[model samples]
Target: MHNYTIAELVKGLQSKQFSSVELTQHFLARIRQFNDQYNAVITVTEDQALQVAQLADQRLATGSAPALCGVPLLHKDIFCTKGVRTSCGSKMLDNFIPPYNATVVENFEQTGAVMLGKTNMDEFAMGSSNETSFYGPVKNPWATDCVPGGSSGGSAAAVAGRLAPGATATDTGGSIRQPAALCGISGLKPTYGRVSRWGMIAFASSLDQAGPMARTAEDCALLLNCMASFDDKDSTCVDREVPDYSASLNKPVKGLRIGIPKEYFSEGLHPGTEAAVKKALTDLEAQGVELVEISLPNSDLSVPAYYVIAPAEASANLSRFDGVKYGYRCENPKDLQDMYCRTRSEGFGEEVQRRILIGTYCLSAGYYDAYYGKAQQVRQLIEQDFVKAFADVDLIVGPTCPSPAFKFGAKGDDPVAMYLEDIYTIATNLAGLPGMSVPCGMVEGKPVGLQIIGNYFDEARMLNLAHQFQQVTDWHTQAPEGIL
Candidate 1:
């Protein structure tokens, strides 16, 4: 029962094989039993979950429900959940109980998907490692000593640990894909406007995108189909139609062109991780998909460019939390300026503060063109690289992360070292392309992910490729010992 996939769970609930309350109880119990060790979930919504489960049972009885009806999934703390603490893993919003739900939350609620709880994440979604989270780092369940990639660390850990079948995650510079890779789960970062960002706390508006994290690509497709849509409130959201992601799951990949970027295979990629990813690519080739070596010359600049651009946008977007607004405020202050400084200094974590400072420096006069403006130009070059590559191939393939999950404090003191874990995933976000990390195989007893990057809005094709790969390989289903 605990190992059931989203598809199986939905079918089980509809067939009355288990009540929604029963399924929710199972997951909530799992959270209680295991989450304390990993610190995956920041808050569990038991009362709301049970209440929603009861409503789902009634809806199931009435034979009227959305596709994900009765499904249990965790919400990343970055998303605002009404009446639930949407902390974004920061002390600033730690006390923030939103009066309204994020669009993603509302979408799942309308579909009868029960929210199990809010999972932990890096503060303001700023760091590649989950250690930046004020609530504490989420441990990789595959190996308790290793770190779970972040800022979507908790979302990945929750799904990978089987605390939830699926969870929502937001990516800004590989937050979704990087963590999923390290945790051995499946995650997708759709095109920029694929999911509404209305109630999702901003961490880099241009790069931020809400996506699904699950154990399988088909499950991700099911959740994403329900999550993706156009929203008028988000001006950046395109007025494009959302396709049926699940419908493409069984699509054959025979004769499909898979591009292997030469730059991605360059030095700095751990040999074991590269070997596993290459083996996965070979497996795809043997299954009839064609593999072509391609190049994205500007790829190496992604990390540096992302640091400038993302932080600049984040600093601008984060200006709303000025203590006068709804977030955390100082207990006592002499004046307005004192209040602002004390509140922010106490509320923000080290990484968030570092980023805010960097952003402000870059966006300030004299440095704007040298830093932020140049980064945006480089961003265009990065986008063009993908456009050029996609012109010849159906999708691009690479190692999701350079290495498996590292020890908790392995890169703790070195921010740049931690940032490099996202070398491959960040380019896709910068280019505004859709990318996914699918469990491919393990390296050094820990999982290594194969990243599938698609052209903008080519998520359906990406899902098809991942689903086909997962169908043949058991990697997606392989859990850590005792997880089942």
Candidate 2:
């Protein structure tokens, strides 16, 4: 029961294999048993979940079921849920109970899906490890001493730990893919504008995107279909047609042209991770897919460019949390200025402050053109690299992160090392393309991920390829030992 995927669970529900309440209880039981060890969940709405599950069962009895009706899923704390605490993993919003649901949350509710509760994340969606979460760091279920990557670490940990079949996560500078890679689960960051940002907390508005994290590519496709759509509230959302994402899962890769970027395989990548990616590519090749060497010369600058642009956008988006508006406010301020300073100082975590400082410096006068503007130009160049590479290939592949999950606190003090955790994934966000991480192999008994990147709005094909790879391998289905 615990090992069933989303699709399988949906089938079971439809066939009356188990009641929705019973299914919800199974996961809640698991969470009660193991979540304290991983700290993946911040809240558990068992009563609300059972109430919703009962309604879903009634809806199914009436033959008014949506594709994912009665299924249970978790929401990242970044998304606002009516009457539930939407913390964004910060003390600032720790007490915030939104009066309304986020567009994604609303959509899920419309489908009759049960909400398990909110999962923890980095403060203001900052940091590469879960340590920055105000609730506490998430332990990697595979190795208790290692870190679960962030800012969506809780989402990744929950799905990987089988606490939930899938969870919603947002990525701005690799928040989704990096953590999914480190945790050895499947995660997708849809193309910018592909998913609406109506209620998701902003962090680099131009780059932030919400998507799905699950154990398999096909499962991600189902969740992505429910999550992606145009919302009038988000002006940047593309008003394009939404497809039935699950329809493409069985597509063949007989003539698919795969790109092997030289820069991605060059230096900074762990040999074991590289070897695992290579083996996965070999498996694809055996399935009649063609591989071609492609070049992305400007890829190396992705990190520096992302740091400047993302922080600049983050600084702007985060400016709304003044003491007067909403969120944390200081006690008995001397004046308005003191109120602002105290609120921010006490609200934001260390990594968030670090980025704020970096953003403030780059966007400051005399440094704007030298830093921010230059970074924008490099961003365009990086996009051009993808354009040139895609012209000759159908998709690109690489190791999601440079290495597998690392020990907790190993890179906490070294900000640069932590920033480099997204080196391979940041380029996709910079280019505003869709990318996914699928379980490939394990290193030192920890799982590694193989990343598949696709052109803008080409998520269907990327997911198809991922589904094919998963069909032949069982890595995604494997779970941590001595649990469940």
Q: What is the TM-score of candidate 2?
A: 0.99
Model 1 CA lDDT for position 328: 94
Backbone clashes under 3 angstroms, per model = 0, 0
lDDT of the structure predicted as candidate 2:
0.92
Q: Show model 2 residue runs off by greater than 4 Å.
A: none
The sequence of per-residue lDDT tens digits that candidate 1 reaches over residues 107-152 is: 9999999999999998888877789888898999999999898999
TM-score of each: 0.99, 0.99
- In the range 146-201, model 2's lDDT, one tens digit per residue, is 98899999999999899999999999988899889888899999999999899899
At residue 120, give the lDDT of candidate 1.
Answer: 95
Candidate 1 Cα misplacement greater than 4 A, ranges: none
Q: How big is the positional error of residue 475 in model 1, measured in Å on the Cα after superposition?
A: 0.5
